[model samples]
Target: MTALEIKEYIQKNGKIPYVLESIGCSNIVYHDNKDYYSCSNAVGGDCNNPAAINIRNNKYLNYRNYTRGVEYDDGKDLISLVQYNKNIDFANAMKYLHKLLGLKNLYKVKEEKKKPDDSWFVFSRFVVKRRKCVVNDFDPMSEDILNDFVPYIHIDLFREGIIKRTIKKFGLGYSYRWRRTIFPIRYWLDGTLMGYNARSSIENCSEFGISKYFITPGMRKEINIYGLWENYKDIQKAGYIVIFEAEKSVLKRDSRMDPTGGAIEGHVLSDEQVRIILGIGVEEVIIAMDNDVPIEEVWNMCEKFYGLRKVSYIRDKWKLLGPKDSPADAPNKIYNFLFKWRIPYDESKHREYLKSLKKNS
Candidate 1:
């Protein structure tokens, strides 16, 4: 009869006849691919169309099907579209049935449909209107380095002589990256375990690891902020972050990857993502860079981060970087560049940033 009625019928009889098509009921699609409609964003077939906002947005599109969010759901079967073969966890069941009934599709556009253009460089080349873009090239050294390794896991950080020499001096579980870098990813308030930071140990290497990605894991939007998992005290005393290209650069006493990235690294942080990070309550940012890029690039980056707060750069921090420029290369020097600079932020700069974003967008 209606979207809500169809849901009720299915809930009551465990099935709804084909007449449910008006309210948008179609077969549940399930496959092993990662694109499985396993989340609310992947809400299945009867998804609402903004153009036809008054109608139900079923997971299924009649003539033009979007396979992006299809998956099987026969009574909570996440992997196959069979009815009630077995009981599944609440989370798994919700993920599966959400795709089957396609309840979540009404809220928004599909992710792939909203993706930015494939043209242009992956991160910073495009304009983002909100705050300065924190998106940067994965590896922005002046030149390219050999990057031919990919492992789901790594063990070099724990080799025999390496950990011993450092552990005896720094303490057990002291964070380090690459060959000789270490940073503060430990407890801040009492005994709470904050994550550790480390950098790769190689000279002129653009990427320290298999991927030069930023990760503040164990953080879910419902639970925690990205950069503020714990150790807010250190973050508070510091006033704001000296946003570097990598996670390794947070601690003044730690090593940061891409210290020379400056503005070239896409240091602009969006107001939405920033508001969440700042909601943890830090004031502003002091972007640090390495000698790998030009000063104008850094200024361009600052232009993107317009609305949040003031941003400044460390003068000679990029110059101090060693051959590899990872935290493991020269831990202390990395910290020197981060703490030495601070700038105030104003929102006006965001106008050009937003305009550029819209044009390129």
Candidate 2:
């Protein structure tokens, strides 16, 4: 059946929770008053502390497997939930759902329409030529372009424990027109201007329909590592690197943790980023994502550098961090303590430790 038909069928029949159970999800518990059901994460198996995954009104699914750094905050439909949990493409997921529901996998057919003709193109000389449009690649911006922003520091950075020296060191700027703080993104190997990340300074900016971050068009934050330009030497000298989620986390740390760098955009590292880190020749990799990120997710990141480098991670097992706090968000002593006691990544040991914590709790 078509995607919409399958979705409607599941919701109308109240089969979302049943689908979860069918897909190997265990410990399914429904909340009578809230009209929702909670279950252990489908991917990680049943947890003594269940509720990492939930379904609301049998239509929307919310799954947060922090250990895996996988979260579906916005509710997902049954098809999407199946696709994600089962690691299958849309067609296969639909087919699986059909099988589970005891239905046939009959796809909807499209109405016939006139097709475009591409046999030949009339040119000035009556030649059969198909013109190909070549898109231009974006060139790197220059440091001189930063002159556009005012050379003034915003108070928000300071409130976040960013010192004046670090601000000036990074050449932070302010945009008068946009009312935002400007952060210049640069190439890591050689300091060349790449783009600017403009952060909204206005309080409750989202309420006013202003986005928190406005990055430069054509800027691929995924491929590059922020602060790598400034901290590459430190990372090499220290024999390890600490990877954080946000750029500010890299700037707010003790200068000693100069080896720390931020993932330009997200908690997950891209293939190119992993390659770059491997090329850096560091002996150890410390995945120090934010507190909200589960150790399981961090452990998954460790797989990238599994045998190539010694992998370790910082987790708030002692309850030092807030719900969404970064290790760098804490004071120097706390950050240092967490860093010093970072757990070395061992698949078997980590799983056992997680089980132990669940058992004790």
Candidate 3:
């Protein structure tokens, strides 16, 4: 079974109490009214706080260490809980979780039933017209609310080479309680406050099975393109906009004074996003999604801008990026290479590229 498959299986079949015990959480106490169990802190040390750890919904876990105040695991998976308490990476944690579940070796475990392929192209076609479902008016949040968060930059982001100027320019904040770097999201057209995108600050957070981003509830991210509120004028002036998969990529480009927009999701662009991008009146669009996205799917994303505007996409054909690294995720040289050599989207060329990928694989 794959890591995702094993994680899903654990969620479906694993029990909360057993998982807690396996991870060294003693004195587990269930709260009947709240539907959560309090246990000895396996995370961040107990300090004799018998019920320091709280497990809720059998999936999410939080702990309040005496010194740390309160911290929640962003990953919100059973394996993430294990990973935290055991001080192990995701793969080792998965192996431990499999043992606790009495499952076979991680690789040897077999699925009882075959699962459907959930690739982006499989559903993107159907959801093309569903873009009208976006809600226009959201309850506005005060900009002053950002004052409640510290302007502390996480070490991981610093390691990513995000400097103070770019961080301040975007109004990024750090929440000690949630342990996430906060991105205040606003309306793309008018800069009206919409909500916030809280991202985990932990190093290798996604690999450790932590939820990478947690947007405010009911915030429709797909309808809004990040950086538009800040860079629309620049985008229009440049006559082109580079579209990245995440906000960090946009920030990376911004530090270089390169105007960009972020889909804030994956490679798939929503119709509303297309509308927003086209509305920017840029003559050209550059798609710079992560390296792992299938070539055909990248072309499908480019298909959204066909004919109306010049659309190109950056791919690591020169072997500059890691398997899943985005163009902006790398140093300037790697990023410059991919961006400078972006291929103009053409149906025939897209097909040829697809054939080459298949042949090479």
Cα lDDT computed for each candidate against the true fold: 0.34, 0.67, 0.68
Locate the minimum summed-lDDT window of 10 residues in model 1.
Answer: 137-146
Q: What are the per-residue Cα lDDT tens digits for candidate 1 across 1-361? A: 2222334535354332222332243333322343222111113433443221111223221112234243222111211222212234222332444556665453432212134545533222111111211111011111011121122122444431233433322232322223323332322112222322334344544653333332223312222122342324445566665555443232222212222221112334443333233233345656555545454555565664444445665545445556435332345545454454433334554454456567766
lDDT (Cα) of model 3? 0.68
Residue-wise C-alpha lDDT for candidate 3, range 1-361, written one tens digit per residue: 3344454465466466787887877788878898767777654465367766666644234333333354444323455567667877444675576677766432231212323544633222112211222223334454555766898667778777777888887888888866788877867755766677778877787897777777666666777788787876777778888888888888877776666655556667886677567545577999988888887777877877776678998988888789988888877777778778889997777677668668778
Task: List the candidate numbers ranked by TM-score, top first.
Answer: 2, 3, 1
Tens-place lDDT per residue, model 2, 1-361, is 3354555677778787788888777778878898777777655644554776666654334444544465544323456567767877444675687788876433322323334544442111111111111111123553555666787668877787777777777788887866888888776645656677788889998898778887776676765788887777767777888888888888887333454565546777776577557545567888989899866567668777776678888889999989998888888889889989998887775676568668768
User: What TM-score would each prediction reach against the true structure?
Assistant: 0.33, 0.58, 0.57
lDDT at 265 for candidate 1?
Answer: 21
Which residue pairs in candidate 2 collide? 66-294, 67-296, 67-297, 68-297
Over all chains combined, what TM-score does candidate 2 have? Answer: 0.58
| Model 2 CA deviation exceeding 4 Å by range | 1-138, 254-259, 347-361
